[model samples]
Target: MTITTREDEERLRLLESVILNTTDGVLIAENDHNQDSKIVFVNEAFIKMSGYNKEEIIGLSPIGFFAPDASSDELAKLKDAIDKCEPCNIVVKTSKKNGTKYWVNVSVAPVSDGSGGFKHWVYIQRDVNNRRRHLQALEEQNKKLKEIAWIQSHVVRAPLARIMGLVDLLSEHHDSEELSNNQIIEAIASSANELDNIIRKIVQNTENVQNQSSL
Candidate 1:
């Protein structure tokens, strides 16, 4: 039997340390012929990210971490990529050992031996919950802004048009005195009230959206 020399042991320790200390979580899954892929190795970052000990996670299927309600379509894509021996990148929500869920960007690639045979599948996972939430909030804010713009262009225009017409009537009837001053004044007051109400509604909706975003 060949014994590992001191130099060889030192190299191994360095490699282990490099993998363990990295921020990105790494998992190595053996390509099993008799069954589903089995997780053979996981680094310390993975343990921390998943809140699971190394002993409890090794030999388990990688899919066990997937959220219960995770999209089946995404699962199908992952399977298809594996079947074709192609790399796959997907973002999925996964549960930790403590049962708390978080978003992760998982990248899977096939590792090959020197003889061109598949050896293992390497998965690199990164937490992306904060980025996802930020994007979602931006989308919602955009939608709200669009709603406000629509109200300004369409809803607010009706009352404004009414005011313009009443003023035009007042101007045209000034010399002829066909329309009474009081009648013109009443029309303008009604249109102004309607416009004020529309503005108030827009303000309320904007405040509501802002509150939601803050939370």
Candidate 2:
């Protein structure tokens, strides 16, 4: 029995240490109006991320870290979700103690005691600024590609079709023209040659674009 008790104590200590030292920010808050939703627990990672020591924040409202001009409606919605014991995820701009604002992906879930009473609220926060910037860049590139595809399909193709149709018309009336109309025939032949050159250039340009896209 003595050995068993010692082992159990060791296990609990290890679990607490792991939670406190984890790299991801973790916080626990109570849902009471008098407490002003004060933080009940915060891991070391949360301290580092928020630039707040445990002593400074343990009994203070976490919402104070949010920007002063932040939307109250959004805060109300978050509070309502917590009140209903529902889990929710939201992107919020939070300010550090130094007043620098940054975007965070925050997930909140209710913690309940085994007896069905509300215990605390758990929050997980991750910085998402880099991920958001990367997604924005990808959206811009996709928009440009769509524009290029439209130009190729409609703008470039229309003129090429007209040139090809003129060549076909010349071929069909080849026998009806007089041999003495050499100059007119030469002009028609030169126009056809120019059209062929333009089509080749368009094809090369399209190929270059496709290769760049593949890269």
Candidate 3:
């Protein structure tokens, strides 16, 4: 019995240590109407992410770290979900101690006692600023590529097609006896060469754009 009790205590201590040292920020808050939501627990990751110490955060409300322009409706919805013991995901901007705002993806769920009574709300947050920026850049690049395709299809190709057609007609009648036939043949050759050069340049430019986009 003594050995079993000691083993159980060691296991509990290890579990607590794991919870407190995880990389993802973890916060446990109690729902209290008379006072602000009390932060009962915060892990080391939460302290590092928020630049707050355990003593600074323990009795404070988590919402105080939210941006000043945060939506009340969203906060209300999150509170309602927590009250009903539902898990929910919300994206919001959070401010650090220096007032620098960053985007976070937060998931909240109810923590309950063994008897099914509400104990506290547990929130897990991850920083998503880099991912958001990459997504936005991809969107902008797609828009630019669409614009370039429109220009190539409409503006560049139409004129090239007309020049090629006129050159073909001149070449077909090159056996004419007229003295100006030689001049016409020369002009046709020049137009055909110029059109080929233009097409090649356009294709090369488009391929370069595509390669850059992939990178």
Candidate 4:
């Protein structure tokens, strides 16, 4: 009996240590099905991540941590999952106590009572601000590259087509009295100049995008 008690005590201590020392933020809240659930427990990681004291967090609603512009649809889906006693995982924009907004990956699951009803819910969240920022930067670069491709394919082709058509017309009508070589040459020069200007503008736009990204 004494050995069994000691082993149980050791296991409890190990479990507590693991929960308190884990890197991911952990929280437990009552699963109030009809109302907003209040936070009851938070781990050390959650306290540090949200920059909130235990007293300030204990009775707060988990929804209070979301950013003002956080998607309503996502919140609705999360609530639906909780109501159904299902696990949910979502990436959301969240805020700290200091009003600084960042991104997080949040997971929630129901903790059921033995009788059948869910007594509580557990939350696991991790800061994903760096990854989100990196992806945004890549998206911006891709947008700029797409614009460059459009200019190359459509804008550049317009002036080149005009120049080619003028050259062909001049060549075919050289003996005819309808058109003069100088006029055709002048038209070609103007189209070439237009193409040159378009190229310069594209280069400038590209350089601007690159410089902004570097910053």
Tens digits of per-residue lDDT for model 2 on 12-112?
99988977877768888886756357788888888888787889878776565453634677677676786687888777877777777767877888777
Error of 4 at 73 (Å): 1.5
TM-score of 3: 0.73
Off by over 4 Å in 3: 67-77, 168-215
How many clashes would you count in candidate 4? Answer: 0
lDDT string, candidate 4, 1-215, tens digits: 69999999999999989879998899888855556788899999998998989998897777655536468887887878876889999888887888888788999888879898787888999999999998999899999999999999999999999999888887786745665788789889999999999999999999988897897
Better of 2 and 3 by TM-score: 3
Candidate 4 is scored at a TM of: 0.81
TM-score of 1: 0.83
Count clashes in each candidate, considering only residues at least 3 apart in sequence or on different chains.
Answer: 0, 0, 0, 0
Q: On TM-score, who's better, 2 or 4? A: 4
lDDT agreement with native, every candidate: 0.86, 0.72, 0.76, 0.86
User: Using TM-score as the measure, which candidate wins?
Assistant: 1
Worst window of 10 by summed lDDT in candidate 4:
61-70
lDDT of 1 by residue, 61-153 (tens): 776555374578778888888888899998888888788888999998989876988768888999998999999999999999999999999
Report each candidate's C-alpha RMSD, comma-separated, in the order given. 3.5, 5.2, 4.5, 2.9
Point out the worst 10-residue segment of candidate 1 by lDDT.
61-70
Q: Native-vs-model 1 lDDT?
A: 0.86
1-215 per-residue lDDT for model 3 (tens digits)? 69999999999999888777788899989978764467888998988997878999898876665536356866776767765779888787778777778778888887777797876778898888788877877897787678777867876666567666656667677455552556665766766776677678767777876776677
Models sorted by TM-score, best on top:
1, 4, 3, 2
